[model samples]
Target chain A: MDILQALANGFEVALQPVNLLLVFVGCLVGTLIGVLPGIGPISGVALLVPLTFALKLTPESAIILLAGIYYGAMYGGSTTSILLNIPGETSSVVTTLDGNQMARQGRAGAALAISAWGSFIAGTLSVLALMLLGPLLAQWAIRFGPAEYFALMVFGFSTLSALAGKNMAKALLATLFGLLLSTVGQDPQSGMSRFTFGLLQLEDGMDFLVVAIGLFAVSEVLMILQDKAPPAVQATVGRVYLSLKEFTFSLLTILRSSILGFVIGVLPGAGASIASFVAYTVEKRLLGSRARFGQGDIRGVAAPESANNAAAGGAMIPLLTLGLPGSGTTAIMLGALVSLGVTPGPQMFQQHPNVVWGLIASMYVGNAMLLLLNLPLVGLFVRLLAVPSWFLIPAVLAVSFIGVYAVNNNPFDLLLMTVFGLVGYVMRRLDFPLAPVLLGLVLGYLMEVNLRRAMAISNGDVGFLFSSPIAIVLWVLAGLSLFAPTLLSRFVKRGALGDDEI
Target chain B: MSNPTHRTDRIVGVLLLLLSIAYGWTASRFEVGMLSDPVGPKPFPYLIAICTAVASLWLILRPDPDPQWPPVSFWLPLGLVLGSLVAYAYLLVPLGFIVVTTLEMALLAVLFGARWWQGLAAGLAFSLVVYFLFTAGLNVPLPAGKIWGLGR
Candidate 1:
């Protein structure tokens, strides 16, 4: 079927009463979590995944709800970035540059309004693009063999080596660390014991939940402890809605950023962070003399906010079509999909159209809901900040632990979680990226099994891996991406604008 | 202390490299069956070991500029947390829900930097609340301690 027909079918599924209700609730919860300091969509979704099992909903409904939370949280993340300098996710770090400046200058209300509208504009447009591209990519990926899949996973891993660390060597080490961690359980092919050290609990391998929650959520709590109190933020909110002139001025910036962000997001490993950075640069370049960009430029607030949301949409393309995740959050989402018994490559479109389209359609509905809910309910969301951290942190940590335990009613997972948390804390202190570890844990086994299967099928012919033109192209691209950072840095330095300007 | 941070990185890298070797040796213990293909179950772990070794070598040879790391004092609480988790694992099945949870929360609260008085009080209160919520409210079966008659 054509993309339009599929979307229409998707709308039919999404517009169902229960599905729509789930989408609304997911958005509401996502925004609340995003507005809270230190929690992102991953935490929100992780906290909620168990609830879905309790509800016993269909796979399609579960994904729609989860995806709604994923993107809805992105919208809410900009709220704190604008009002306070604290970003809920790294994706919003660029938003804080001009957003908090606007807030301090008494245009806090305007900054929030522009951010919401820009999110809406970018989100809606990106969904439209997703509608068009998802089907094409799915159809194209249908021809992939196991060798191609292995090469694709290799491409995904190499991106970490290319972009994840201060230098290629460090990134490669981080990737190795992730791969080793991925090996901590029973070997898939040999049924051989590895790294388990005779502990019965290690037989099944490390749970992604244990690793993810410990690394992202628990370690974050430890980091928060290192600080005395969060930065003080006071906002005099005025005119919660955008004025006509303000809307006109920001709309152009939003459009430009959305296009730029979508393009960057489509490329594996270039996600919201890079998109936001590029959007900011472009907005500044256009603003030139009028650029109060680093200060309180309203366009400054709009650009990154729009770009990041668009990039989030762009990330779904590779995940859904190619079974490749462009960012950490998407990697978790892919894990969630796999756990739900859904293989997220081209075949998913054929086998589970409802799940794919329902997710896409929910994105449209979710963006609208976020814009509407955030406007009048901004005060209510901000009130969450006033809750004492004593109650908030413990309750959140307990709930996360409960969620982990609920999976198997096993306390061993809890022990594993705490250990991973400490390891995560140490890794963070040393400036290592946590995302690569996750990507490795989720993809490592799959890459290994596929490579082995492909080799076995070829009867030990080494040339079989490179025989495929697609595999050769991907390997070449991976090689080039390894050097991309150094080249880009040199090019930027040699240009007229200094590092600060870019 | 010229590159104090690099020292930690180098040490950690070496340790991780050792871990990779250990993992590879473990993989080798399993009779690695070749599926008539160059790649097998052991191939990925071996690749990881190789990459880790190379990276660790590079880190030791050309370490990045070091920065200050957190002091050992901060790790003190980790002991308490770990102890609490271990106790919970073993005692949850034996000691009744109320006793185990109360003790665990109390210790955790103290470890989280709360004052002793406040930690004890808050911990007891929250533990009771959770006990009631999970057991009385939700009706899920909970661990009953040696004093089974009192829990029942």
Candidate 2:
């Protein structure tokens, strides 16, 4: 089917009353969660997944809701970062640099407005890119053999571990732990139990939702408890509308950052946080020493906001096309899709056209909804910051508990969630990146399955893994990604030496 | 007092090393067919075990110089919250969703420094709303306590 016709059908599905309502609810909930400190897109989506299952919505509708929350949280994240200087997640950290500055300067209104507009424009643009790129990538990926798939999965893991956090060893250990956890069930090929430890619940392996809620939601609650109180927000939001001159001034920065963010987003493990940072830095470099970047510059707000939203959209492309989630948020979305019985990969377009297209259409709608909601409702959202953490924290935990219990009505899952939550807390305290672990768990089974399948097809010859050009390319890419940080640091050090000699 | 935080990395590394050994040993015990496919499930586990072992060793040898452990005040609240969650997990099915959830939420709120009465009220309101939302709206069959019949 042509893209236009597919989109038209998607609109038909997305515009249905129920799906449209879901989109609105998703955006509202996403914005609320995003506006709240410590509850990021990952936790927002994780908390909502079981709710979607309970709603019994069709796969497309369920995904639309969850995806709506994903990007909606991106939009909402800037609100807190701007107002209170506390980023809702790492993705919004750059926003805090200038967002809070703008708030302090009494231009909070302008910053918030520009952020919403920039995000909407960039989000819509990236969706356009996704609409164009997603199908092509999926079509191209259909030719991949198991070996290629395995290599690509490895590339995803390598890039994730490399960029997940500062400590490569910790990131690697987290990934290994996730892989170990993924191994704890009956082996799919042989029907032999590997690590069930003689428990009935363990036979099915850990539910992704359970681990996600534990790691993101529960851990977040625990972490929030450690804080004495939430940060105070400025009461008077100056003005909601941006001046025409200011909008025009930021136009180019938004455009540049959107594209940069989209490219960064498409790269595995490089998410909105990196995209926003790169965009902000690039814009700063473009302005050279004349930049007033950290001092409430409107362009600072616009660039990161635009870039992060664009990156969010860009992150979806790989997930939709290759079934490889680049970040923790996308990993949760991948888990949601898998639980819905929708396998996202090269064949996703052919097998689940409505779901693929409906999600795309909903992104457009959800972006528009966010823009509409955030602009006029900016005051309302800012007020949400006043909701006491004492009340909010437990409320979120209650929701997570009920959400997890609702999944299978299994108490054991809750116990598992608690265990993982504790583990997540410790990992966070230790500065281990949590995202890579989710990525590992999400990809572990697939990686193992593809590896064994590739070996099976190759009749036990390991050389077959390198026989395919695509596989070889992917392996090389993985290796390069793993070494890229070290290589770049070395190059920079050498450049410094050359400068010193001069 | 050479950076008290540095000790954490060493401790974590030693613990991880021990974990990897146990993991690898257990992985080795997984039943594998002698002639069954070349790359069985055991290979993946063993691979992870080795990676973990190596990474832990690296962490032990080159511990980060400036790890910032949470302050002493953080533990009491952290422990309280964690303990409540574990208790919630165990009591959820037995005491029922509403009863245990309300109590757990209240405890958590208090742990976060809420007043006792305020925490109890907020927890009660929140848990009741959630209970109704899930049980009635979403068709999730939350447990009612055999002791009180508060939920269905």
Candidate 3:
């Protein structure tokens, strides 16, 4: 079916009572989590995945809820960055540079209002792009073969490794660690056992949900424990209603950032963090001497917020088309999909058109839902921010434990969950990237299955991995991605970190 | 904080290097006699071990490192939290849900630095809410004890 017809069908599914309610609940939960310091959409989705799993959701309904959280959290994250001077994650860091400054200058309401509107604009635009671009990419990706798919996975892994780490060696090590973790279960082909340490639990390997929640959520809790910043008190809280003039003035900045975000988002390794940075720098360069730029500029808040939201849409490109996730959030989405027995790749668009198109269609409706929910209810959400951290901690822990238990009606999973959580906490304390671990857990089985299949096909030929042109190209790119970090850091430092600043 | 952070990183890096070597040694013990394929399951583990060792070495060799160790106060609380979790895992089956979870939550709250009564009350309330939500509302099963008829 054409994109229009697919979208129409998606709307039919999305508008149902259950799905719409789920979308709304997902958005609210997402925003709340996004507003929380240190927690991002990645952990937000991971922590919630068990709930959805236990809730017995249809795959379509599940995707709608998860995707809604993915995008809606971006919008909520902008709020905290603007008002509290604390960005929830790296993506919102740029928003804080101007946003918090604006708050200090008494334009908090205006900045908040414009950010919400800018998000709405970029979000709506990206949905239209998703409707058009996703189908096109799906059609083109239909030509891929096993060798091509293997190369694509390699490319995906390389891109993420390079993007994730501070240097090439670190990225390589991270990627290698991921590949190694995949070897911890019974060999898919040879039936040879690996790394199981004689434990029966290791036979099934690690559950991605366990790894994801433990690494992201548990690690996050540990990180939060290290914070010296006091729990945020409401600061000059007010309604977030934009003036017509204010909206019009920031419209151009929003447009520029949206396009910039979309482009950056489409790249394999570049995520919202990069998109926001690029958008902010470009806005500064374009504004030149006319604007304050970082000193409480309205355009400053608008640009990054719009770019980040648009980038969320852009991040989906590689995932839907190539079965590769570009950011941590998308990685969790990938995990969620895998849990539902869906393997994402070029063929996924053809095989699961409803999931792809329905998710795309829902983004449009979800954005509208967030914009409506965020405006008048801004004060209400900010008030929620006032709930004691002590209370929130226990509540969240309880819910997470309950969700895991309900999944299998087993306390063993809950124990496993806690163990992983402790492991996650330790990893975070050491500054290790949690993303690699999640990537490892999810992709380990697939990599093994494919490697075994390829080996069997080639009949013990070592050169089969490099025999294909696609494989050769991918290997070369992977090699380059190992070095890309050092080169990119130099250019990024000049524009992003400033020459003199840390 | 900075000195401790760097010191800890160096210690952790060295430990990881040692761990990777052990992993490599263990991996080498997996026998694949005359396997037709050039690579096998063992190859992946050895490769990972090598990479881990190399990365750990690199981290150790760096002169200046992030000079921020998490506070001992923070870490101590986390340790208690983890200890209680382990305790809960072992005790839950024997003692039942309410008794074990109530103890777990209470202990965790105190470890998180809550005062005694406050921690006890909070833990009890949290456990009760979970019990009701899971068992009553969701109709999911929970362990019932002989005494409470619900927590075991």
Candidate that would win on lDDT = 2
- List per-prediction Cα lDDT, in the order shown: 0.77, 0.86, 0.74
CA lDDT, candidate 3, residue A418: 74
Error of 3 at B31 (Å): 4.7
Best by DockQ: 2
Model 2, A1-502: lDDT tens digits are 6999999988998999999999999999888877888787888898888888887878999999988888888889888888888887677899999889988988889999999999999999999999999999999999998999998988888888777777778888888888888988888888788788899898988888899889988887777766565655556776788999999999999999999999989988888988988899889879877769999899999999999999999999999999999899899888888988998899999999999999999999999999988899978888878888888888888888877887778888888998889999888888898988888888889989999999999998989989988989999988987777666766678444322211
Specify the poorest-scoring 10-residue window by lDDT in model 3 chain B: B143-152
lDDT (0-100) at residue A463 of candidate 1?
75
lDDT of 3 by residue, B18-63 (tens): 8789888988998776564545667657756887888787767652
lDDT by residue for model 3 (A217-242), tens: 66566566566334658866565667
lDDT for residue B148 in candidate 1, whole number 0-100: 65
Candidate 3 residues lying further than 4 Å off, grouped into runs, are: A407-415, A487-502, B1-11, B31-40, B61-64, B111-114, B139-152
Task: Score candidate 3 by TM-score against the native.
Answer: 0.90
Question: After superposing the true interface residues, what Cα RMSD does each candidate give?
Answer: 3.3, 1.7, 3.4
Q: Which ranges in model 1 have alpha carbons more than 4 Å from their true place?
A: A231-235, A487-502, B1-5, B33-39, B71-73, B86-88, B95-152
Candidate 2 per-residue lDDT over residues B1-152, each given as its tens digit: 34666788889999999998998999898767763577877888888889899999988876776556679988877777777777877787668887887888788778777788998888888878888887788887888775675643
In candidate 1, the residue pairs with backbone N, CA or C atoms under 3 Å apart (3 or more residues apart, or in different chains) clash, namely A455-B37, B96-B145
**lDDT of candidate 3 at residue A250, scale 0 to 100:** 89
Write down the lDDT that model 3 would get. 0.74
